[model samples]
Target: MSAESLERRTRNYLNNNVPQIQDHGGHFEVEDVDEETGEVTVAIGGACSGCGIAPMTMNAIKHRLPDEVSDISKVTVRQANGPRAAVMPNKTDEMEAMEEYQDYNPPF
Candidate 1:
C-alpha cells in the first residue's frame, strides 16, 4: 500500500479508538508515523499519564494498530504527563469528584 493510505488508515484507527480510551479518563493520540522507519508514535494523557497499566494499554495499541494499519513496524507510546502526574499528588477529593462528576452517567 502507499504511504499516504497507510497514514490515513492509522489516523482513522486512532480517531475511532481514542474515545474508548478517554472513557477511562485517559487520552490517547497519534503523534507521528514514520513511513520509512515504520515507527508510529502515540501520546497518552489525562489519567493514563503515569498509571501502572499504561504498559498494558500501550502494548494492546501496538498490537492492534499494526493489525489494522499496514507498514507500521513499531508503535511508540508517549506519556503526555510524566508517570508521577498520573497519581496527581495535589489533587483534592473535591477536585477529583468534580472531574469524575463531569464524566459521570446516571445508572438509572
Candidate 2:
C-alpha cells in the first residue's frame, strides 16, 4: 500500500478504536512509515506527557497498530514531548505535593 493510504488508514483506525486518547487530550501522529520493512513510528503527544498510563497506551499501540493497518508489521511509539524548562508544566504546588505524598501513610 502507498504511504499516504497507509497513514490515512492508520489514523482512521486509531480514531475509531482509541477515541479515549483524544478524549483525554492526547493525540497520535504518524511520524514515519517504511513500506519495505513494514515498520511505522508514532508519536503520542499533548496531555500524554508525564502520564503514568502512557506506557500502557504505547504498548497497546505497538500491539494493535500492525494488526489494524495493512502494510504495518511493526510499531514504535514515543512521547512527543521534548525537554521542558520545568517538569510537569502548569502543575500547582498542591498537585506536586499530593503526587509526592500519594504513597505516604503517616503512622498516625
Candidate 3:
C-alpha cells in the first residue's frame, strides 16, 4: 500500500485495460499515488478526455481501476484545464505523435 507500488500497479492495470478502453478512446497515466492509503491518482488523457462521452469514460475507469489493482483504495483522475476537465483531449505522447505523423502531409 505504498505510493510506488500503487503507481506501478496502476500503470500495469491501465496497460491491461487499454484494449478495452480503446473503443472509447480512453487512456490514462499514473501521476502519483498516496503512500498512506495507497490511493492511486490517474490523469485521464486522449480523446476520451475531451468527448461527449467523457462522463461515461470516467465511470468506466473508476469501475475498472479498483478491480484491476488490488492495493488501490481510491482513484483520482486529475482534470487540469483539458485533462480530465470533462471536455478535453489529453492523449499520450506516443499516441499524439503517431496521430500527428499520420495526419502529416509531406511537401513533395
Whole-model lDDT values for every prediction: 0.67, 0.74, 0.61
Q: Higher lDDT: candidate 1 or 3?
A: 1
lDDT of 1 at 51: 59
Tens digits of per-residue lDDT for model 1, 19-53: 65677787766678687878888887777775555
**Which of the two, 1 or 2, has more lDDT?**
2
TM-score for each model: 0.62, 0.73, 0.60
Better by TM-score, candidate 3 or 1: 1
Worst 10 residues of 3 by lDDT: 99-108
Tens-digit lDDT track for model 2 on 6-79? 88888888878888778878788989978778888899887777566566677778887887787898999988
Q: Which stretches of candidate 3 lie over 4 Å from their true place?
A: 20-26, 80-108
